[model samples]
Target: MMQYRVEFVTLCALMVLAAGAWGFVALVQFAHAAEPHGFDQRILLLFRDPANLSQTIGPAWVHEAVRDFTSLGSVTVLITVILIAMLFMLFSRRPGGALFLLVAVVGGQLLNSWLKVLIDRPRPELVPHAAEVFTLSFPSGHAMLAAVTYLTVGALCARVVHGRMLKAYVMSVAVVLTVLIGISRLYLGVHWPSDVLAGWCAGSAWAVLCWLLARAVLSRRRAGEGLAESA
Candidate 1:
């Protein structure tokens, strides 16, 4: 029974990884087109007032709120969260888990950077940017990192926690954060919609790949322990 469950999980992870990779590749082709996607501009326009493109559609407080949510996915914030989580894991005597998380996050960051440079998509210029951005914008770094960090951490947390409901709650929060971060990029006019979508696709794929690798390693370790005990 346990073996069957593990196999099912492995299958699901592989499916997610494949779908995400395919989606990202499709988005890359769209990004490379001579003109911006029509929906990209339309979505960006939706967030801004028609008369005043400089200002977002929402009230002043809502704009500030969006910025706050966006910051959660910023490099500084994500790095800080990773460091803190690593420290927690170490103190809890889960050094292996801590190391796995660090490698996963750092690897994801490198992948995101490489993709951005490879695509070299420019930031949107249709409306004024609500936030500062200095990097190439094919895949929104905030969106990608948010998906990577939050989803990875959430998966780890779910493994340690008890009960299906609790695990579901943790993963739900992670998904919500990732989705909001992507939307915030669109609202802020710093990234095209396709950029956010690509970020999500690539980030999700990377996260699932890391999870599958970790699971395989754990299974091997357990099998080795079983063999030793039998011997």
Candidate 2:
């Protein structure tokens, strides 16, 4: 009981920290004053070759690695993750867990789309894009989705997992993957630093919010069942 309580408190603290950080990021984005194209150019340029903007500042193999990480945030990849996680939940006879991620992920995507339109920020042209992009770049869809998918799924799995070390391992992988995908966007010159940062903030906040909601739903369901048994 104490362990569960500790874990719950830890998750709560993380969610609050993530929310506060995201708000700060949004404030910075808002205060950029005219959305200057060069707001983060100096750092961005460091990722690309100075003379050849189309190429990344690394060996050929490094580009391949970045692409692999970026693919985790792709539409097909995200969909696959959702389907697989849902299947796992259903296989385990936990439909609620499955439903939670589905709603959270799809909702996060919609929220991200709306935010992009509202911000109307363009892709970074400070350095030539090493990757193709089709959507507005205020908040990176890849970054946000990575956070939503990995963190939500990780937290759910952590609850069912038995050991503290194992749970830490799971959530750590999720955070690392989220961070990598975000960095890949910058390395590929496809998103501004601000875009990736905002995405991380928004995504983490949304995932934590959904997790808490799921817990509430589960608690109420259990309570209702308990009352029926007592009756």
Candidate 3:
């Protein structure tokens, strides 16, 4: 039964990875075309005031709130969270898990940077940006990093958690944070909707890939120990 469960999880992760990769590639093609997609512009404009494109569609507080949420995905905040989580894992005597998380998140960040440079998509100019941006906008770095870090952390937490409900809650919170961060980028007019979508696809795929690799390594280690004990 445990073997079957592991197989199921492996299968599901592979499926998600494939789907995400496909979606990202499709978006890349669209983004690379001579003309930008109309939907990208249309979706971005939806968040801006019709009369004055310089302003967002909500009260001052809403803009500030969105910025706050967006900051959750920022490099500074994410790295701080990661460091805290890693220290907790180390102190708990789960050094391997801490290392796994560090590699996964840092790898995801490097991958995001490479993709951004490769795609070279420009930031949206249809509306005034509500927040500062310093990177290329093919895949919103905030969206991608949010998905990578939060989902990876959630997965690690779920593994140690006791009950199904608790596990689901952790994962749901991760998903919610990832979604909200991506949407905040849209609302802030720093990224096109396509950019956010592609970020999610790429980030999710990377996270699953890392999980699968970690699982494979553990399985091999366990098998080796079992064989040695029998001998």
Would you list the C-alpha lDDT of every candidate in the order shown? 0.92, 0.84, 0.92
Put down candidate 3 lDDT per residue, 133-210, tens digits, no spaces: 899998889988999999999998898898989999999999999999999999999998999999999999999999
Could you tell me how far off, in angstroms, the CA of residue 80 lies in candidate 1 after the best superposition?
1.4
Compare candidates 1 and 2 on TM-score and give the better one. 1
List runs of model 3 lying over 4 Å from the truth. none
Q: Whose TM-score is higher: candidate 2's or candidate 3's?
A: 3
**Clash pairs, model 3 backbone:** none
lDDT, model 2, position 78: 88
Task: List model 2 lDDT by residue over 78-197, tens digit each.
Answer: 899889989999999998889998999999899989888887887877777778899998788999899999998898789789898999999999999999999999999998877888
CA lDDT of 123 in candidate 3? 88
Q: At residue 117, what lDDT does model 1 achieve?
A: 91
Off by over 4 Å in 2: 1-32, 35-39
Return the lDDT, model 2, position 206: 85
Q: Write the per-residue lDDT of candidate 1 for residues 168-223, one digit (tens) a residue.
A: 99999999999999999999999999999999999999999999889889889999
Error of 3 at 49 (Å): 0.9
